[model samples]
Target: MSNMEDEYDFSHPERGVAVIINNEAFSTPGQEESDDRAGSSHDAEALDTMFSGLGFEVHRYDNLTSSAMVETLTAIADMEIHSKSDCFACAILSHGGDDVIPDNTPGAVLLERQDYVLGVDSGVVLVASMISIFSDTRCPGLEGKPRLFFFQACRGTNMDPGVGVKVRKTKVNPDVGPPREGDGAEQTDHKDAEEGNVDIEDSNVETNYDSDIDNTDSIPLRPVLSVSPSNINKDILVMYATPPGFYAWRRDTGAWFTQSLRTILTPYNATYWSLTTLLTHVNKRVAVWYESSYPGDTSMNEKKQVPCITHMLTKDVYFRPKNMKHSTLV
Candidate 1:
């Protein structure tokens, strides 16, 4: 293991490779240029700058087809650089949604949902497919190393109409006694505790579902391995721009999630704070600081977005300062 007691090692000369896939234009047969993503280039550029500043070898790919996307990732996973690098990171900015297919069981009617990103040609690429390419058995060079992925796209067609917060001022009676066991107050406390536990477990659940896509072709299922590798998905992290069944907001300037990420994960912060700490800041910023403000569409106004982060890292991950020299491994 290259890591210390609780932290992943970043003492190698090469920090790692960072890949940015930006899909700004849609060339599907019936889709218009209006469907083209207007501000995705800004996201791509910002990620490139931010990752490059972190001592990564950044590779940027623009407007690739679904097949091309897979090929590109396959080539990267086959590279020898991972043996010497400390981690891997990838950011994808594109139109994305859920891939729904009708289950073909006799007298059964059901729709299966799979998450995917759109290629420029309107072809779909499953997010899971991309992650599987870097599994331990497939990309041995990155075994036990952190693999980070960031996705900026709409998860579904649902628009969030933020709930109004009402503040009620009430006077408390001085004669009121403290709540006893089995009272309303005690039940409320227990409920709160249960909710707190649910919140913690929510981070590990895969609840995100992308918005609708126009493609009619059925999405192929990933083949199940008869024997799964123990470390197949050991040290991976995936972050999405929005919660399940919600639209990710993007202005003409840039995407809400990417902007917050670049702002929060600066070199100074990266050196002192864990990656999860920085992402928590990013989540807070995106959820609180942004809201949809379309004047013509009242229903779309005041919408909120919250990013979701899931990780399976066995140790704390940190990005060292770019100028810092490699330290002797413990």
Candidate 2:
């Protein structure tokens, strides 16, 4: 267990706000209702229950357009309640892909790619642009407080064929540990051969539009105060549904990442585990316990996914017990 002083103080009267953005329908100019995401509501409801049980004020938004997404997030960042809260969290579930740009080098034919999430209207919003709204210079109320962002969307259309692992049978002994080397053991591939249907967050037909249509440019600018830019990005954590250029899977139940997250961060578990520890457990659950079973598509069958987590948190974070009374810890 970590010392109390090492953990971010979660004892403030307000635990914090948790914003959930669930985009299930798409109605872009050329898109059909068939492009809508299914089962995203399950994720939203699970997140709401989990965060609300953790004492957070949960606010859920559904089917927002690109401009509405930016507006909603910007308003949350400007909320005065943040000044009295201990942390902040936001989760976005929608279709996502890479933002491609023409390489400008002379005679270059390659394209540059950046990560972005799509709004219901199929508008593009860079992931970086969303994080910038909560920078220390912009959202002063959240300075020095942990800010968590969770994205459940595909980064691209690539499928992951998991690597093979060697399995060995050996005698068990109390003092003996697992072998470090394979020792020429036969390798076995683990794949889910069951017949089932799964959905990828990527669109079947790529939508084309002017790159200048990105809605991030229209984000309302806040007054820039004289804060050190050095730590503008401090105390932030971002978790993506999948690695770059990989697909995120969903089913009738919910998204794999979100279901695993909800399972691992139960109210009881939150009391004993640090937030990072919980997330690691979530990573393992999603990576090992789940796999695509779309037998109809051979290429997508048995595919695997691993979530990506990046953080700049300076200290450990712990969620307070539900029944605990509030008191300033620092």
Q: Candidates' lDDT values, in order?
A: 0.69, 0.70
In the range 91-197, model 1's lDDT, one tens digit per residue, is 98888765455557788665555567888777788788899999899999899889999988766666666544433322111111233353332111212111111
- Candidate 2 lDDT at 89 equals 94
For candidate 2, lDDT tens digit of each residue in 269-313? 666667888887777767755666563566776677888888899
Candidate 1 residue spans exceeding 4 A from truth? 1-4, 27-33, 100-112, 166-232, 322-330
lDDT of 1: 0.69
The lDDT leader among the candidates is: 2
Give the number of the best model, judged by TM-score.
2
Candidate 2 has an lDDT of: 0.70
Query: Model 2 TM-score?
Result: 0.75
The 10-residue segment of model 2 with minimum total lDDT is: 211-220
